[model samples]
Target: MTAAIRLATARVGDLAAVMRVMDAAFEPAYGEAWSGAQLLTLFALPSARVCLAWDGEQVCGFSAARIAGPESELLLLAVDPRFRGRGIGALLMKDWQAWAAGEGADDYFLEMRADNDAVHLYEQSGFSECGRRPAYYRGNDGMVRDAITMRRSRDRDGED
Candidate 1:
């Protein structure tokens, strides 16, 4: 966070760097970090887009989304643990929305662990809880966790 961070559209070649960020951002106890093969498959999808936040040559954070019709679903968002609390996560969210808007998205949605503390951050970003799925994830501790779906309506005019 000491150095200024810049957001950029991530290229296919950046997959490894983005996966590294995902690994560093998610804890094993949470069982939420995505595998490289999974990410590689997503990158190959035409509906998917990946964006990266860079501090010099290093990727501090990244976000990915799937766009279909007028709807966009945030598939993943992560910031390196060391870079957290520095506003990188919020930046990634904003960038993701902007990109979605430019792609003609009018409805944005995302789902995450119900107990995730980041819920407040999403609320502040204009998302509202729209639905929930019970026992959607089984954590490493062998406890089941619920998933909450949050959504935000974007104007077709494209204003963030």
Candidate 2:
């Protein structure tokens, strides 16, 4: 049976998968910088919401966000390498955006390495580069990389 992609509220049981994808996606860039405990805290935070794309028991993609004080932040998003370019990332993002808007967020923010290829996807989804942080990420070899901060607005009253 083929697993369908859908949206659901994240639960404590999802922590293992969340850690897996986050480390898989950021390992090259963050070099084990984030521990599972840290990820658990983020996932368990009241302001943060998570959505996962699953293929049966396996998680193919995931997106996480934090919404509070009229602002939201996309903390993580990733598609399994085998599932990239299949619109799964977009689906996860859309789910997060909808949830953010419903929670009273007027805008969303995300930060990624300037060189990350996924930056284009975020841009295509209407995110705009708002600023940059120098030496924001610690690479595998101990080198620091620049990060670009992006933002997207959902309009007053949450239109579009």
Question: Which numbered prediction scores highest in lDDT against the true structure?
Answer: 1
| Model 1 spans > 4 angstroms off | 1-3
State TM-scores per candidate: 0.93, 0.88
What's the CA RMSD of model 2 in angstroms? 2.5
lDDT, candidates in the order shown: 0.88, 0.79
Please estimate how well model 1 matches the true structure, expressed as its whole-model Cα lDDT. 0.88
Put down candidate 2 lDDT per residue, 68-94, tens digits, no spaces.
888899887877777777788878878
Clashes of 2: 0
Compose the digit string of candidate 1's lDDT tens values, residues 65-101.
Answer: 9999999999989989888898888888888888888
Model 1 — which ten-residue stretch has the worst lDDT? 1-10
Pairs that clash in candidate 1: none
TM-score of candidate 2 against the unseen true structure: 0.88
Residue-pair clashes per prediction, in order, are 0, 0
